[model samples]
Target: MRQKDNGGHVRQEDGNVNNSPPPTLPNLPSRRTPNFPSDPLQILRPDSSESRRAQLSEPSRGRKGASLAAVAMTKPQQQSPPSTTATTTTSPPPPPSTPPPASSSSSLAKLPLRLHSLASSSRSLLAALRRSPVTTLVAAFFLLALFMYGEDVRTLAELSIDDYLYPDADFYNVSALPPLLLPPPTCDLSRGRWVFDNTSLPAYREKECTFLTKQVSCLANGRPDDLWQYWRWQPNNCSLPTFDARRFMEKMRGKRMMFVGDSLNRNQWESLVCLVQPILSKGRKKIVKRGSFNIFYAKEYRATLEFYWAPFLVESNSDNPNFHHIDQRIISPERIESHAKNWKDVDYLIFNTYIWWMNNEDIKVRRPNSTSWSEHDEMPRIETYGRVFKTWSTWLEQNVDPASTSVFFMTISPLHNSPAQWGNPNGIKCVKETLPVLNYTKPLDLNHDMRMYDLVAKVAKNMKNVPVSLIDITRMSDYRKDAHTSLYSIRQGKLLTPEQKADPQKYADCIHWCLPGVPDVWNQILYTRILSKSSPPSPHPPLPPQ
Candidate 1:
């Protein structure tokens, strides 16, 4: 029998129909498949509608088939409908056995789920916070404190003596320890003798140091008392810790220490330099002089030791280094800023001004607004001293930060110009004395001018904020009558003539103490005071076992 083909072509309806395939339909170019292959396998494949229909209808597929179906569900197929069919048919797809690979649409579909999960977590956290608000605030505060003080806490855990030395009760309130247990600094320690020991002779040789004033260089001027070179200050009650120059430099690293006062302070300043300079290597030290200010820099430590010559400790006409007249000294009692402006930002300040005030019988003070000088005649020296100290104290209270600065007031350095004051009628001055007054029992009578000692002590005691230490070198220094420069002091770097040297009473320098002498002991006391004020780390408590 003959049968008509779907394309209206003649075809025999026999078993050979399977062997000879029907003619292929013309393939219109599709957007998805622009270059469709004309291969027989591609043409023989089932249409998308039929394939999806088979997958939907067959419910008992094996594991392999299910996996294949899952892959097919994930990858969408592209199709082009035949022109003969007016409408295309599509079967509903089966539910995916496994989720599709991540894509923009898939990610968007999961966004709502993620948002719901986040909202649930946030609600739980809020509920927890509401239940324990105090706990939450405390935890936050603890975290903040830890962030701020973490390093300081760690440092306190591992403190060493090399790092710092603890302060005593004199500097601050040490209420933790009982009064009996505290080691108070004794006055007997300050009143000891200078014993002969070649091992600890001169800190720096006078011949080598160029910083020494010609007036104080007794060793260079051929003094016969080599015993003075070997003599060391020995405190009666407590031993003074030998000054460690390296340790001192380390402590003073990147700091500015200044001596603000008269040439007496300059004497102590030179002594400190001699004490520390022996440790400095070549090219490690430098000296800079500008007008009345002299600065010595230790390059390795970045430390500066400066001296500003302000004899009155306030503004004075005698402030000039070269033009300061001994008898014509003029002071402006309130005008301190002209001198104090340079003293700002100092880490340590050592001040002395008692000797200059004693030069004139009447103080020539310039009034605040007037050009004429007013004489403060026979004004009890203590009252005059008190006014000046009040001005200084006011300046300190206003300008100095107690947390950053350490201040010291050296007590009056006694002068031995009159040997009659110390009960030696035969000797006119300190010219021929070879040894210190060893067994002096009577306290020498220092009159009203020396009453400034009690005033300074009272002022320091009364101060509540800034603690100024009074270095009382007077009593101990009074015993060292043999330590002065005397006739050995140079006059303009020239040896005294026989005529001038004969008059030891006139040419004797009983004012300044000799270097490698009593000034060293003064510096030692200064060192101890400095160490006593430093708030070093305490011993940490034992940690509890985990």
Candidate 2:
């Protein structure tokens, strides 16, 4: 019989050296014979799945020699000759014997193979990332920012899909944040400062030698007709034609207009109605508020003209007497959104909020959401106002759609209490000056007024699609120096005391315009802006109350 290779030592089969030895190793010098069980030679043959599993279980044995690891993993079919011989059927045995070559080790030796190289490179990258976390995170953030910048550019170039799908959508227009629209505004320091001096006043050659004084003796107890006639005589150059009660009634016959603001806003609204109500035969005009906040509907024009007195336009606690004066109580963006639902769906949206925000030391508005200012607060008034308006405009841009509605931001209605601007620093208290007169030697420095101008421009700039027009009544109205009700003296209608009649310019009501007075000029400008194309002669028959 041919000598059989015992299960005790390494066997050489057809030039292949396979290790399937007994416990004894020739390299070991210890010759003491310890009775050891015969090694299973068949285990190395890979003929049974159990043997193959057993072989993989010993990673150290599998990795003994570099060649053994390579042969065991690569060309496993050829290395495991017994298994190849055992499987005579078309399908080969599960040769999971080669543990599918672990992803880590084989990837090490076969560094030249693209798949292995890729795996190795990935591991190296992971290790490198672990070493420099900050740098990796910063690089990732930079890349993300670059991606967002590109996305913004794309958004500006085309209408976003969200725009069309949500027609009533109120998305803030980022473009409105820029100062681009300010330069193009028609009213500004240039026009406002241009005063009509003794020489420049001649621009108008009046029929009378009475040298049209921009100032006129003001009225007390309100004379509607005289107020109407006075403003027509001195219409601001930038403004539209003077108010014609008859004509305005006809023009606004069926139209609806609204003014929304605080008590001051109501002052103008009441002045406007009084001036025009006289033009209507008694029962033709009525003043009514139907589910309207501060709105006033006049009977003659059939116009539902009204005023909504939401100074901030956001709902907040009104119970606190100081709520109106406290800066901290001012509504925040999140708070404003809570009330945005009520402001929508209007033909023309007019907004004004200034005096309400004039919170100074000792006067603080404390909203549950906003913090009260302390001595440590250092923010500028303009900055605070800018931020507030920014939030407001952003919400406006997001909620209002220009396609169906028109938006307007009226320039802050100037208060006549500023003696320097009204040409009466000491004696005049806005009550004595009634008639239209040029009392100021120069145009008032409008730093306070320009804040509103700049804000409107800023809002217009950042807005997209919405053509927000500015009703710049500030500069236009600034020219009427004597128009204020100075010292409460009636000029054109009521009889006055000898003392009152003697100094007509001393007792003027400075705050409100003589409706049928200068404010009519503002309304005319508004009309020109809205109804210019048609320029319907002031509507006849007056608007009926709605």
Candidate 3:
């Protein structure tokens, strides 16, 4: 086990600069092997300077199809193959702060779609057709088929099919099925359980309207701009009617709240800090990192907000050169609990690990025992992961004292990469398409992509008082479609082009939400859930300086 200083931090090796550099922590390259675009918003372009009245006032094509076709005709030409050198983008640092617009969800929903068309020469197609029309058509057909298949796959996957199909699928070999958590004994108190303003908050800036559920708002206090006062200014009712931050701190003061996972989890951590920072004086709330974990402590409350980067949460370092070339495994279950052995002292624990596991090489996605990737056999067969998590769950059941400690497992954050949903399939990740939480009653199976759901549910059933709560952020995020950082992260200097500044969606981030962005909603949900039971210590009534 790594040794820790009395302060609860582990010291790092001197020469390990890149891996152990000071905390605090993008770019799309053109050439340089055509790297992935860091800014997801730039992929789609919606006209901002022009007025909707002007376009409609002087209508060119009577039919919507004709107008769309005309817009397509004016699309920019894709850059040709580079002669030798490559091109890349360096996204600028984030802006200091900004004011959000005042618009209700309904008005935001009526926004128009941002459309872009690529101009390909007929000659280019003819030459390729002459060479292999059949091949080109066949490839196109295959792609179309795949998308069609994906749609069906997504539909089937989203449904509540866990019971019927996997009746005997013991999430953990030790556990059977878990009971269904009905929406809440009834709708009144149920609605009050975790309800925020009961309306969505607007995006920090204007972005595209595509892929967004027309009227959804980003959850209030979910963004930096929305909650900066609460964090710094120490405002009351920061989590009013639903969550009461002061009450939460009173309950959790001197206790701990640990969010374990990858960077996405960190995003939520930062959001939470921003939400609560204002409660304390400058330097009173400090963030310090020592070894494998990082902690943010509010001295007034004696609460430490900690983060442990255990994407896999189990030890799986690269023993092989190939694995090292990809990602080094870091945890071993046998040795895993050692890092978090102190977790027993924690008052609350929240965990997540999904996107990191999506990569093919990370773990043996397709087992050696399986011949091919089939829809039927596509159930994640990470035998080793299954065993490790099972052990982890069993560990939690044994370790945590339900009376004092609460545990939560956040759902997989969704990825919006498709063209039909976001309009800028080639350009953005999850940029400006901010909308409200969708109200679809459609049952979508979260099995295929989120293989951990079943395992977690099964684990929950077996654990006695832990009452593993599911922070279902997936379905809600899937609909936001536009609320990612996308291309904004790639802009290099503080200053940006008029086009860049005007197009908030193009410049915003995709992979992770901004400080006052979407993740704050997750933290708010967490706050509501944890505080409902007990009141945490307040940061007020300042204690002597540490």
Candidate 4:
């Protein structure tokens, strides 16, 4: 509201229209605004509607008639003694010294009446809001946040299944590339719910996976739960085929399929190895681990399924699979060649990198040519991520042969470190958990989520020739908070014992998925994609050249 100055020039109440709409006022949004508002999302969004509403709410806008609340704001309170019963004569109020000439316009006459009604309504709303004075100036912020998230989600709706899988940056110019090795956009496999099918055994028994690392072997580690292993991800519209180990091996006869990322990918790699291990005899297959590479070779088919530990997917000190410290994390984003040379020519390439890069502070990065390993520059996370992908995308354009190679990006595997995510405020991280989150409709995620899918999707879109299909296993995996290798898993290369399991907070491994569990479903989805189109013959006649 404006007041007349001694010199008669009006000044703004707040010379500060706060730069970003001063934190939303206590839910100023009232849909029951029949007597006042007609604009949409007005209280939150400081556009023309809000500006116009503010004008009507101001007492100065209607000098002829001030609202009840407006008069209270302008006046000060003073305590006085109770009035005595005494008759007193009152003088008539004086008129203004210089009254304005009367106007004949109906708009001027009717304006104050409308403003009075709106001002009263605004005062009533403000009074209700003032009862609970919070930091927020408006309640519409929650609505705005939902609207934004809703908008961000629908951006993908423009994309087809092929586009979702194999994003062509130039959505208009897709014909330049060869045919994508994905099924037509019929039913979205990513948008699905989990099903309980304890009717049969899981893809593989825990005891039979001889090569399964003890880190992910929860059942063998002596945990008491098994319901996490029985659930299968079922697509809402389409019936996915069961994983056939023999058929999958047959398709990759003389080729290589590698899972290249962090331990989560290693978790998937172990799941895949276990899935197909039963088909071959012991002598026919063997797993070899040397430095960062873990290979499981099939003697008969000459096929290899491997897992490479490149958490950052670039040159980094943490590349060594055996030993790496979380605190002393470092990377050379522009130099991926050290690790790229290993899995560059693989027939089926599955990639994932997220959890390792999620640090609260800036990341330490070194230049590729630096001789002194001690010298480093601290770079922000997202910037470093962008540079790493830029190098990776450049490498893909130069090295990968789209005709022979089918590239895949496994989406970020979700972690269940917070019990509050699943509506259990009292529970610990993935410990004593039995079943997968059954209710898909419930808000089982954190209010403040850190999803890197957008960045991954953006990077995939910018690729020119290479068609990297996204095996969108994030949302589906998010429901499996029960599937993580919690306290039942390993710590520092050894499994946790009974006494150690008692303290879940210090020992829980929520980042990695337990075998015969979530990763099996990931493989099921991967298997679905694998069966869609047969792989082309390996360009290098017998895979890794003799």
Candidate 5:
């Protein structure tokens, strides 16, 4: 019979000379068993140093037999059979009395040298561990880390592009989870971290969207890195739903959605068009410029996404989205009908106006029938801003039907005008920033942005007729110092020149964000409101009714 010694190598034992049948053998691994990584030591126990050394030793008594393990796993597809002629011998197989066959001798001869070298290396490793424990530990750690990283790379290599863009599409049970478009009543949508996930982010690609204006197309304007496109917003307790453009369009089927306010609203309006455009058929979609509105129409669904240029949400001298960069700005706070007239019949209305009002401490207020700068009164910005919003609110209360039209007031979109605010003291503006700022020692509830945030919420709460949903994005926006268009955007209707990009302090366009970046996330929040048909809660408490 064939038997294994303490070292686990096979040797022939004595048997009946005349009547013995072919010796019974232990189960041996064959060509059918593929050993991955094809290393001889893989079969040994990882924690047993003695067994490792023993496996590398020659069989006892110079039996002419060997372990056959290394040769069994040498080739993945085909390996020559180990010599089995000794198994049928009548007496115990012994060392050859004369010179053996060349085939058998050469194969067995080279194995001992290989085993001797391995044994010597194993002893040296043990001696090193004993001599310098710390050095040996560090080397072992590095080797282990290398092995794990190689495995991760191998796993990632197997994924396809489809897997990258739609990973978790089927992971959530849609019917069981909260409304795909609505935040839970208690869920704090504003409290979240920006998660790095290359698989399913960016919401859309910069090159794919035909609706983008050059002002927000940072990637096309000589900016280099594309890593900014791979972030997903993860709330502290809940997750935003996976966006389904088809479903959103179906819900807004036969409806008109208008975004009314400043260029910031127009930025958001452009994002919505890009997101919903891919799902529309080529000839079925078209955009038109009509008066103060840029309208995107989905013919099959009969849906219109309209943007109206109303920068203070009331009559302002800068109301013209094009050619609104006047040296002096003026507003007629009470005269909002020229702007609100277009918004009265819309099914969904989203409004935002802040960055334009922040340029000067005092604003020029022109009363009715006053067009000249000579007839304007310079008032503190807060009072003028407050009265302008009040005019917007009063129009909402008396002009539109609450049951038919939904109103949403977007809070301030914070600015990254200073690069020093984020750790770059030598930097001039939002350039070369690829990640959102995350480590705030305290929550962002005490800045100038929050002051505007409180005022917007307080105004919305005071209204009794209109159920206005305040999309408070300011707190979350404070952390995104890296997402602005900076010098990639246009100034005075002209794309920034090389000289302007070089001088960020004078021409860095920090007022707006890059498309396929922050604005995409903003629309996801907007889509949530249209999805659930329920008002998303505001982060601030409403003031007491007087």
Candidate 6:
């Protein structure tokens, strides 16, 4: 018969215990049992009733066997009882002396539970991202675009304000900028003196140009004093800006500018061409003469500087540039359509007609119907000048578009035929005059008919539609008595003879100015006027699409 010990180990009725090892138990912290106090003498004693009760009440058979084996090993074998005295009653084994078997199995079971919890959290996160894909894509694209185009967006914003204020200045990197707050240029450009500075002499050489006339080529005709070329015009209240040839050419590019009037206008036209020619390369310019029109074309700039010979500013028989006699001057005062046809399309027109109208002879006027000339001596010089200018002004009002064209009338260039006009009793003419008259505090009395100037001013002022600016060059030119061609002028491509040269008072050309001289200053003033009145450049072309 088999009997169970209190430690759950099986024992024979003969009192011999079976010593087999117990089965392994699953590791679980909650199933672990507390360790009891160990005793060295417990193995020799019989099991108590409480131990027997615990062995019988153990839940799993495998766990009960493991616990019983641990207890048997820790307890020593008890002294065997006599067979006759051992009545059928079996003794229970003592409690375990080692740690409980559940302790090791409990720790092993905790790892799998922790691993299951982490996998459950990962699945929940993946489900949330899959629900909304469009929002995720839009956010990603916005960040990428900002990274690629950030600089370009910033540059466009900065240029928007800069381009509004300075429209044309975007292309060139100019070194100096004009003052933001500057007083408007006044009409008194002629109120200053001629200052002597060698550095400012001769804007261009006379021999370099093929269009230069011998009548005005004082340097080419061998004048003694070179100091006349160095004098610069300075206004009283403000300083005159220096002429920049490159800048002027840039302004005149693709434009047609004409000087319309007498040979005096030709003098100024040549002066302007020479002033700007040095900045252009060779073969870049050409001169074309067609009828009464003389054109200087700068090829690179596409600009034409032209002179049309209309000395009286009307249709006259003296319009023949080559062979017309000065005494036979007759004008059709009502008819200017012939000359205005060529002048209408020009961008800038500088009209001058003064010295040619100063003749005291009986003037001849051609009426529309009458074939015969009508002589008028009773009409004063001012009335005749006014009638002709009225015809010109009427033509301007009818034809010229003031928005597209700029019109200027150069005042009468003064003549220095009589030195007595400047209080010089001994000096009769402009000959032998080396310097400007400095001591004469009073204005020099001139033979130039001032009535013509008054007529021009009146016509320009009265015009309501057409705008005309009068470039008053008279007073400034009056002080330049030393700047004339004088006895040094070339007559018909020939130098004056010794006899003619001896009497300079008779042969002196006190009318036209020497080249690289006073006319250059006039052009400088013209340049200033052009700059002051000019509109800003057009807007920049639109940028290409990205």
lDDT of each: 0.62, 0.44, 0.46, 0.66, 0.65, 0.66
Cα lDDT tens digits for candidate 5, 452-543:
66778898999899889988787677778778787777765467788877788887866687888777777888787677674333222211
Q: Where does model 4 exceed 4 Å of error?
A: 1-184, 367-369, 447-451, 543-546
Model 3 — which ten-residue stretch has the worst lDDT? 16-25
| Candidate 1 per-residue lDDT over residues 1-546, each given as its tens digit | 222111111111111111221122233122121121221111111113343334322433333233333433453332322334234347565333223354323323344555566799978876787789896797679879989976544433222110111111021223342332212565455566657678877666776665666667788766778565556777766676666566566556656689988877888887888788766543345455556776776644556787888888988767766554566667877889988977766778899888877865567777668765553334444566788899998888888877888788998888876667777878877888877766667666533265677888888888768778888788778777888887776654466677888988777777776777788878877876776566332222211100
Model 5, TM vs. native: 0.64
The TM-score values for the models, in the order shown, are 0.62, 0.46, 0.48, 0.64, 0.64, 0.64
lDDT winner, 1 or 6: 6
Candidate 4 residue pairs in backbone clash:
24-136, 24-137, 24-138, 25-137, 25-138, 26-137, 27-138, 27-139
Q: Considering only N, C-alpha and C atoms within 3 Å, which residue pairs clash in candidate 5? A: none
Q: Write the per-residue lDDT of candidate 6 for residues 1-546, one digit (tens) a residue.
A: 121111111121112221332224353123222121131110111223453333333343345444433432343333322334333435564333222244223222233444465577757745654776875577568768878975544434333321221122112222365542222565477787878878767776677755566677787787988767888887877777787777777777656789999878888998998888776544345465556777776645556788888888888877767556566567878788888888865778999988777777346676667665554223456666778888999999999888778899999898898888876779858988888877556677886676667878988999999889988899889988899888887655466778988888778888888888999899988888887885534222221110
Worst 10 residues of 1 by lDDT: 5-14
- Candidate 4, residues 1-546, lDDT tens digits: the string is 221111111111112221221122232232221121121111111123344334334433232213322322343322222335423446564232222233222123344555676799878876787776561346567557768775433332221111111111121233453543443558788777888988754878988777777777788888787888888777878766677776677777767888999878888988998998787643446676656777776645656788887899988877667666667788888888888887666789999888877765478998658985477889888778878888888888899998889899988778788888787889988788888887668545642224357777887888889988888887788888888888877666566777887788877877788789888888888988877865576665443210
Q: What is the lDDT of residue 497 in candidate 4?
A: 72
Model 2 lDDT per residue over 1-546, tens place: 222111111111112222342122223232232221121110111123443333333433332323333533463222222333343456756553333355334423343354554788878876887899986798689778879675444432222211111122122343453321222224332143223234322212222212111122232233332332433423333433334455555544554456665544555555455545555433223343323243333333344455665565544333121123333443432356644544564555666666555544222223343453232233455665666566677777787766655677677666565555554568444544444444446556533546646876887777766667777677656666555444433333343556774563444445554333455455555655664433333222222122
Q: Which stretches of candidate 2 lie over 4 Å from their true place?
A: 1-229, 233-239, 242-255, 271-285, 289-292, 298-303, 315-334, 337-340, 359-379, 418-426, 434-442, 446-449, 486-509, 533-546
- What total of clashing residue pairs does each candidate reach? 0, 81, 62, 8, 0, 8
Taking all chains together, the TM-score of candidate 3 against the true structure is: 0.48
